[model samples]
Target: MSTANRSVILAETPTAGAAVWTALAGLAVAMGIGRFAFTPLLPLMQHDAGLSLVQGGWLATANYLGYLAGAVICIAWPPAPARAIRWGLVSIALFTIGMGLTQQLWPWLALRFVAGAASAFVLIGVSAWVMPVLARLHQSARSGEVFAGVGVGICLAGLTALVAGMTAAGSQATWLGLGVIAASFALALWRPFSSDGVQATSMAGGARAPLTGQAWIAALCYGAFGYGYIIPATFLPALAHEAIRSPAVFGWVWPVFGAAAALSTVLAMRVLPALSSRRLWAYAQLVLGLGVVAPVFAINLTVLLFAALCVGGTFMVITMAGIQEAQRLGGAQPARAMALNTTAFALGQIAGPLTVSLFNGGLKLPSVLAALVLAASSLTLGLTARASARSAESRQQTEIHVIRDAGDARTNPRFEMS
Candidate 1:
């Protein structure tokens, strides 16, 4: 069917409004499995596949590279963004299946790249679809209960993988489980994704273009956090068991991280309108730094759990806000700013583990993470302050417009008298 027919059908449906939120939630779920859960499972994947650390690193890098490629592809190809997202989810599912069936380094690497690319499409496309509708549907209570799908999926996926790996069922079982989950979501989205996401597409189109200088600073700050946050996310469990000597305790940490993320996203949305994004970013960064690096010194269960909750809860939201702000700054050219931010973040993801690994060559992973967190905290503060200042100016201008409109109304004596 054509776009007009699609729109008309949606307009006629009693459930149209509700369906939009469901589509949004679906996208969030797909993204969580496709993008966020892999890091926690890497150790198992490496052990089962008999892959060396370097090869595992390469596979992770391939995913980031593929994400970068996918972001560009979505802009260049302009496949129905919703459809692209669904297709990407399917690709992730299939590649994950391939991971289960094949163990040779090159094929796994290629599959991971495909998975990464698919993950990008799922995340960007889905967010683009839902963000604008969320913007209009509710101004004060910024809930994306849909986004919670990500947290839930991540929590479940990591919990499953950690348990499977620990049970000595081997890494393949974890991979198989992930494949089943991903494939199921993929097929669900593929069959009727377009009809489900009508409003999401229209909303996505409102994103702005090339970012302001201030926005770039914000992006850089976010990218820096990406560098720091991902190290623990990708390798915390492995570090917990192998480096810190507590596989059992850290196994539980992954789910805690996911649960915290779900809680944080919901709470953050509720609190979004009350404070400026800058304030939130600053506080969130502080929490994240303290959380991720705390494990460096206190290699205990309590500290590990605390760190997982802090970082997992805040990092993704901060990145999401950064992209949204960039779009606000550069109307119609959001793709460039967002791409720049994502690419920088991906580069950081690529760098974080490799850098930590070098230090972990019989040294300390947590120490490296601590140092990076300190740096991230400092940078985030600076950028948050800058963005805050700019926002104040923008709000001031809006206030001026309101005042001028009021003055014009006052001066019109006829209307005033009336």
Candidate 2:
């Protein structure tokens, strides 16, 4: 369809609601099935495909590297948000199906790498396209509903894996199943993400601003968040399996993790309406740190579940807050800022699994290190917020003084008539 026709259709329909739901479904496929379905399927692959922990870590690293590449590409030469999202979702389905068809590690690595890149594109595209529309419609709060899709996607993927485990299905079948679901979602979303469905005013037609010092700091802290949550996010199911030998029982870990993640975004919106995004992000990071270290004290079902709740609960909250903060600071170039943060985040993710592989899959030291990074980064973000507040206050006070001086001169008639 032509851009004019697409605009007319969007105007005739419930544009805001449709955009939000489309973004939600798109994210579910992108993050849930494309990026994280592998996480839940890892143990199954280990069992049926003889995939060792080291191999799994390598697979994860390859995906993260692909994510980094995608983010960098966005920064260098971004495609239109709608176009990127459409193609990204389609690519995810194709690559994911390819995963099911292959048994070789090299092919798996290649497929996963491409899938990872596609996931990044969808994530950035959704954020770029949907957020501006919501803001324009005076429904910025609805963004929570949109981001909640990530958790929903994760939850669905986990449940599918759980079912597969309970029924003694092979990893290949589960992969194919998720791929089909992703394809279905992509098909449904294809039209809604038309190039002219909703214009990204925030992202389009702006002289891009360079990243500031504080922006760089935020990006680095976001990277810390990526490293902080990823180990548990990537290996929670496997960790639970070690604690509880039953697939039926251990499979609950990922679903619980996903559930907490999905719920937390909505709750954060209602519970902390007054909180600043930076503060919210800092607090979530602290909670995530605790979750990251939870399994280290004792590796059991309870501890693992607690860890899942903590990590899953806060990761999405942190993600939403961090990206919102970037948008606030990005100043006519929010997409670029978002991509920079995502690139940093992807680096952290790459480090996380590599850390596990380096330690030979040991959790204690890696968990402790990740926690420390989270703590330190949290402190930095908190401090940055304080500094920004002070800077604004000082500027306001100076402006007030100048206004007072001008008024006094006018009243005194010493400078007004001259």
Candidate 3:
């Protein structure tokens, strides 16, 4: 290739990669730090911040409540995706740092609520904005690459806590440190999320489509995945702490969970390129169901780790597939559809801690709920398949009828006589 050709090729190479990475960074701050920094740090809060288990549960609920509210607002009154992304990232950084500035319970609750809302806005906004660009670039498969940020963020949060633990930084210092990190990432990603850079695509028919039955099924399954995963995710360290009573060992559970999650999404795309998003989603749901029940059968550290691997590995991949399916079903208005799924997911997260609290045990009621929802999700897939088949059959019959009518008209005796 000539020098100019080489320069053009080199420039094109970075465009897709840069877009993907920018998205990755955006999600890391919005999701990894804003939404989930609390999970790994929950144990830390108990030790240093005088946070009770009940209070921690309430805080988790508060965050999800904020997330739910955010999703609702996004759907009811859709905003420009680019603007939402920029403002959401800034809000995430501010609220995350705010968590460290105040140790008061009410203030912490308020900050967490805002952070949760910020995270949801970023998630929905980024998905709305980025997926289309990738599709236009014929990089639809790379959407998984974008969604991998959630796991990356989760892993980074865990690692940060691990480092904090090593330095004896306590919860307050850890919060401050993560907040600064989130702020830096937000500042870096601000450029990519600009209004001029990420133009909103027009939906087909110049309007958003109504949610279909299949879309609702996908949303429900997504919600189930959220509830099922949050239990092990939110409380794994605490569970490990109960068994080992050492931060050294228990601290590793979250990192392991996050590492598996981060890797799973990337691997899933390569492993299942031919797989339909719905099928991938269904299989992931099954795996998550199995993971949820692992601790119920055995309380060993090994079993918990296995459970973490299962839940972490599949949740994000399922999320990616679910969102893609929503877009496929809803068409043109994927953001609206995605917002609904996010709302359902937030509801599931809100319910998870409360369910676990009610049971006061590991992996009993939550496992059952996860399994039941997974089963229902699978059933919905079957129904959709059957419905599709029947529609195909009806189309074939109509075609046959049209052919017969045409033949009869051509063979009419009056026309032959004329």
Highest-lDDT candidate: 2
Q: What's model 3's overall lDDT?
A: 0.78
Candidate achieving the largest TM-score: 2
lDDT of 2 by residue, 1-418 (tens): 5889766746743467887888899999999988999999999999899999889999999999999999988888877888889999999999989999988999999999999999999999999988878876888888888889999999999999999999998899999999999999999988888764455444453434356667788899999999988999898898887778798899999999889988898899889988988999999999999999999899888898999999999999999998888787665568888999999999999999999999998878999999999999999998889775554355446656766887888788775746
lDDT of 1 by residue, 1-418 (tens): 5989877855633243553455545654455666666666766765666665555556667776777677666555544556766777778778777777866778877887877778777766665555554554543244335556677777887788767766866676677778888788777666545643443344235333334566567666666777777666766666565654344556777788877776776678776756655556667777777776777776667777788888888876666566565555434445445656666677666666567566543225644664466466555655567665665467446656766776878887654535
Deviation (Å) of 332 in candidate 3: 1.9
Q: Lowest-lDDT window of 10 residues in candidate 3? A: 197-206
lDDT of all predictions, in order shown?
A: 0.64, 0.87, 0.78
TM-score for each prediction?
Answer: 0.80, 0.90, 0.86
Clashing pairs in 1: 208-330, 208-331, 208-332, 208-333, 208-334, 209-330, 209-331, 209-332, 209-333, 209-334
Candidate 3 residues 56-155, lDDT tens each?
8878888999999889988887777777778898898888888888788999889989989988888888887777667667887888788888889998
Residue 323's C-alpha lDDT in candidate 2? 89
Better of 1 and 2 by lDDT: 2
Q: Enumerate clash totals for all models, in the order shown.
A: 10, 0, 0
As for lDDT, the candidate ahead, 1 or 3, is 3
